[model samples]
Target: MENDVLRNIALSYSPMIDRNRAVVATRLTVSALRTGGPLQADQLLAAIAEVWPEGGTRVSLNVMSETLLNDLLRAKPLSNVMIEIPSFIACDPVNTDAILQLQGNTLLLHGRPPSMLPRELLPRFKYSIVDLADDRRRNEVAGQAEAAGVTRSVGFVQSGVRTTAEMEASFGRGAVAILGWPIEDVVSQSGGRAGQPDMAVLVELIRRVDDAEDVDKLDAVLKRDPTLAFQLLRYINSPAFGLSVEISSFRHAIMLLGYKRLKRWLALLLATASKDVNMRPVMFASVRRGLFMEQLVANSGDEEMRGEVFICGVFSLLDRLFNKPFDELLKTIPVPERVYQALVESAGPYHPYLELTKAVETETAPVINEYAETLLMSLLEVNRAVLGTLTMAAQLE
Candidate 1:
């Protein structure tokens, strides 16, 4: 995946946006080789300051090589950037004092084993970032850090962190700040050539328009999955729908939303249901994207456009969903030209809406405002839709 896409996904699920935590994670992407050019610490600090204005933003600098380390140390902090240094820095006894000098400005130790921490340095190391690869290791490290008179902020650096359970577990372990990748399905599911039954349900729903004409088949399918039916009713009756009367049954829902709208809701269901826990965040984000786009399109009073935008939002993660390249996957599914443009090339008339969806994911003020102006939508409207979408996801669960 592209770095920007990965960053967007990571940021979408991150609790840092809530701003309740004392320590915040600050991510950095830099190469140690200096293949592109010299590391511009000034520019890097400026960007971090803008996104993480809070004084407690904890930055994890991925040190690639010794050369990169030297460059970073030379650059002075302009915006109170508290740099975190690995405990391994003390391995070299020659530069121990120099490294300690940088301590007051940032944390001296970054989640290392107690054995690795030098005895002399223990008295100097007041604050640390703890390593939390697993429960046993986390407890051992946290206990060790505490004994040394060091307080810690923790995180999980290992890969394959995909579910709500995993995320919450890390935080429960006393991680004031945690860091993980963009949350995608790292583990492939077992099962067959045609994919899972739940996925097939989505395909069948799309292919069968007869259900719209004859509500009996649609009702039968809903009957087969009572959970799906209940969720659909709950969604239609939600405050976002602004319905005075509640939707009580599948047939009633079909009558109100029609076959086309019903198909879209089923598509949304397919996106949310994933056998692999890693895909949960991606799926949640996809549903939110669709709902956001639908709100933007509804404002224009264009019924057809609203449907297309929803499709665009829901199916945006097909490549990640199937673990296949997007271009190859698009050939198998039959979507409108507008959706193809928005998901693939990111061009055409619907492209602007997709752009707005992306901006919402990033939650950056400048980017969100820019897209809002392009769609003639107020930032307030966009924010409300985002909050509504998140609420909708929780209710669906």
Candidate 2:
């Protein structure tokens, strides 16, 4: 569908985290739509399904036109998509008529409750997307919900949240979910002083894998840390792995994955072996970066280079992951010169891929365009890598 008048579509997603900090659903925004014109409903829905096949996808329609949106809503098959509409569009006569026509499709999303939304329009929207900053300006949670707290609104997802305090305050007010995690806030406090997967057992397992030892031997190492063993199982069992039956043992998971893919997965998983629960978002980003960078070079590189590039992407954030400088961390774990060069020195062939991955993550259209142009890759090619990585990474979760 590349030539279907759609070009350079870039997607950025925010995990809709529950109170427990686990992702319940994903909020997706089409940061950049087709260069030709507004995207069609079928194309957009198809793209969402392709990227997030497991469902629990909330498609934000802020970039869509009211006419196209109404058309899509009327004809779209997936009634389960949580459509988030802006205040201006939701109240529009054309869109409202289409929404009301469906009758059962009352799950329209908009600003915080008691927002500019007219009193009569309240019942139509069961979900609220509150910008924490703006909401605080009007109805301050500062004094209202103190230590003990007051009654908070349920089912509203707070956006514009970027700090630990803001997240706590948002939840302190009873928000059902948070739109996105404060990864930057957490990482800032960490300030590169992070944990590592250099645990004795993990190091041994890495050695065993590198030495081409039997899977059973590796299993022995994993048994030392049941959590590590479980993570291996979960990652291998992830939908992206495409195993027919469940793998109850680390040895079995490792055997099916063989050596090459296992090496790549292990490289990404090692960085995420930290016990700090707050690093979930960072870990998530790390894994996706690895996948995104790997996919970006899939068409151009050899098998071994692809794996190294993948490691390069995962290890780029090694400073923030291992609680140490790049030189210090790389000294412990054996990495290729290129991977080290890209991560520590940030000057290598893979460095441009790393830079492009960051730009794509931020969903900055012009910057992404610049990187794509510099890399001499078509926007369509770059976007495919972006969407493909997002889809695979989501499956890993």
Candidate 3:
């Protein structure tokens, strides 16, 4: 009956994209109460196979109790299917031996606990670790395994418990920590935990760069954080700016990219400091609005006007970030009069475009259409351009 319910749920929500390759899999736990007869395993496997087809479905049997192993071995008719054996299950001798001889394709160990398996039993199957919350233990296990020459792929599960220091340490030691949530969540939670630089420090770093009259001082500050150094190198090498040669170091990038470009890059990084998914869509929208407004004003041959438009669009979403009203945050940043007017009262020249962007974001379709018509642009053209800008902004991270 549980299998039937799962099958119904799977069928109700179809795959987002239909492809021949199988990406979705089902997990199951075996219990002594239900493992009374062979027919139980047979029925469960049949139900999953019916929904996802052979080789397309993966069934993991989480062994919570030691007595379930005997029932699993007795149910060998289902051996052709893949099953997951938890690493902790090795605590039981009989279950340990059964797992070693099970010939399964995948073994999922949770928490990276110390393993006591015999040397001979380790090489038979592929395995991955799950729920690895403690970074110190995770790194110790991964490093020891690598040093012992265990070549099978090792993956870390990010339960959001590991600090930024743990993540940097694990990454430095060459372990792939699987971040369970989005990158924003990782940034928010991990910041300041693993000695990862704090936002105030980042802001100070940017200020130092801005105040530096010489390239050497700026380069020294940039090198303080390897991650920031890497991002600067990547931005310098990106094809969008069309630079002639590869920038090898922070010093070289500072000399070549100039202070203005460096400040812009730092601003972009600060904007992405938070990894909250709730704020991602808002950030993306703000970036798009800023870039689009800049392009519009620049094409009109008004350089100063373009700068104001860009600042206006970017600061438009400031309230969402600081959790205050827009006017309240505007007073904190030193922006131009026109930009302030547009945000506060929608009275400036750029106010119409800002209003249009807000209208689209709020799903006021009629208002968006009216604004496009008023601007002498086709509704489809405006929408296509706005969506294209949005897509580009989202990839900034």
C-alpha lDDT values of all predictions: 0.57, 0.68, 0.50
Query: Can you tell me which runs of candidate 3 are displaced by over 4 Å?
Result: 1-198, 205-213, 239-245, 249-254, 301-308, 324-337, 344-346, 373-384, 387-391, 394-397
lDDT winner between 1 and 3, please give it: 1
Residue 42, model 3: Cα distance from true site in angstroms: 50
Per-residue C-alpha lDDT of model 3 across residues 296-332, encoded as one tens digit per residue: 4444536568656766776676554555455775554
TM-score of 1: 0.55
Q: How well does candidate 2 match the true structure in TM-score terms?
A: 0.81
Stretches of candidate 2 above 4 Å error? 1-8, 32-34, 53-74, 102-120, 137-155, 187-200, 207-220, 237-239, 242-260
Cα-based lDDT at residue 72, candidate 2: 63
TM-score of candidate 3 versus the correct structure, residues matched by position:
0.43
- Residue-level lDDT for 290 in candidate 1: 85
Q: How far does residue 56 in candidate 1 sit from its true spot (Å)?
A: 27
User: How far is each candidate from the true structure, as Cα RMSD in Å?
Assistant: 11.3, 4.1, 16.7
The RMSD (Cα, Å) of candidate 3 is 16.7
lDDT-better candidate, 1 vs 2: 2
Q: Which ten residues in a row have the lowest lDDT in candidate 3?
A: 9-18
Alpha-carbon TM-score of each model against the true structure:
0.55, 0.81, 0.43
Models ranked on TM-score: 2, 1, 3
Give the candidate order by descending lDDT: 2, 1, 3
